[model samples]
Target: VLDPNSFTGQEFMMWTVAVYGDGWLNFWKELKPAIKTVAPGWSEGWVKFTTNEAPLMVGYATSDLYFDEKSSDKSFIPSEGGYIYIEGASIVAKKEIKDGAKLFIDYILEEKFQRLMAEKNYMLPVTDIKLGDEYNRVPTSTKLVKVKTKDLEKIEEYKKELIKLLKK
Candidate 1:
């Protein structure tokens, strides 16, 4: 399980409201028994899922391209839509080459490179581009869930409760 303080886990804990409302405690209680193993390393979990050692793990739908193009393993966007995890890039400060880094960033934002992200990386490009048939086949949702301010207030509580359930 991911630490609730993490970006992914923070978003996931917020999603509990959409799925279970105030019953999140009970939800975790029920799920705890179903967890066969907990490998904190992300790749370790991915390896298990790809090898059929595990049936499920929380991950992006676009991840399917990593395992197999036509494999039965597919991801679905929840009906309530799914949380979008944003990514960002920045040049490390101590390493100079500021101009080169700027050029690299500019290049990555170009449509050509964005297409490469969709086709090869299996990530939905930040820019609008016609995805290939295979990439287009990846599931998408029109609606997206936004975490409310009230949920933000409960992040620490979520961490504690989730930890307790997992431990118990």
Candidate 2:
């Protein structure tokens, strides 16, 4: 288990701010009491969660897809909102193999590729690929929260504040 006073929590707070925007610090403060044991990272946390050492642990909603037997675990999308970490494929500037990179990107965006990724990687499809029944069990909120690119400019400052707050 990670020490609650450790920098891990502070780093998580920083990530929360980067993805969920402002007010995460206040939420963390409020929720701290309920958080009994903290793990050094997600892998450790996942072990704790699976072994029932922790009643609640942070992870992807689609995590159930990786399990052999579908767990009763449910993902709750808070009425306030939830954060989505978006992943993208980008072609680096001045790349030697630009055509290959473009082809890869195009292939990735295809429905078949998206479906395969959603199934194998246990992640949400970026394209309009049909999802499996497992995905239906994951609760989705209409009010998903996102940090604007403009707000991202202050991420470093937010990290500093998060560290200070966690240290307190």
Candidate 3:
């Protein structure tokens, strides 16, 4: 059971973690059991559905260290895996590209444009262009081990296969 005494006046707690693409669903399964084992009184309704009556806990959709330090206690596991998602870009046939597409690609690669992309689009830049503290929605440090580009490419390939299988 959760030690209510441990959280008498505490607002929240943080835990250290790492998220991997394959492990995302597993994390939720594990979290539910952990929460239950520690806090048996925690109603299933409270944790499942999101409604007006439910106390909202905005779980950060980003990497680990994001919420740990903000928690009431420092009880978190250090995860070794990195999150992986297969995202693809496609140009629709309906959309006509009057100008050259190479120029658009070059602009996207430039640091200046990437910084602006992060600020305006909020998508993580694929380049090393530092979107300073002001624009960093996710608080990641140099310490965060980055997932290799090759790994991401493999994940993308796997995702394509999975999609093809589903279509059949």
Among all candidates shown, the one with the greatest TM-score = 1
Per-residue lDDT of candidate 3, residues 26-140 (tens digit): 4444444334222322243324323334333322223222334454422221244223232344444656764556577677678987777666655577788766564433543
Better of 1 and 3 by lDDT: 1
Per-model TM-score on C-alpha atoms: 0.76, 0.72, 0.34
- The candidate, 1 or 2, that scores higher on TM-score is 1
111-152 in candidate 2: lDDT tens per residue? 999998887888798888788877776667787666667656
Q: Whole-model lDDT for model 3 versus the true structure? A: 0.39
Measured by TM-score, how close is model 3 to the native structure? Answer: 0.34
Count of steric clashes across candidates, in order? 0, 0, 5
Clashing pairs in 2: none
What's model 2's TM-score?
0.72
> Which of 2 and 3 is the better model by TM-score?
2
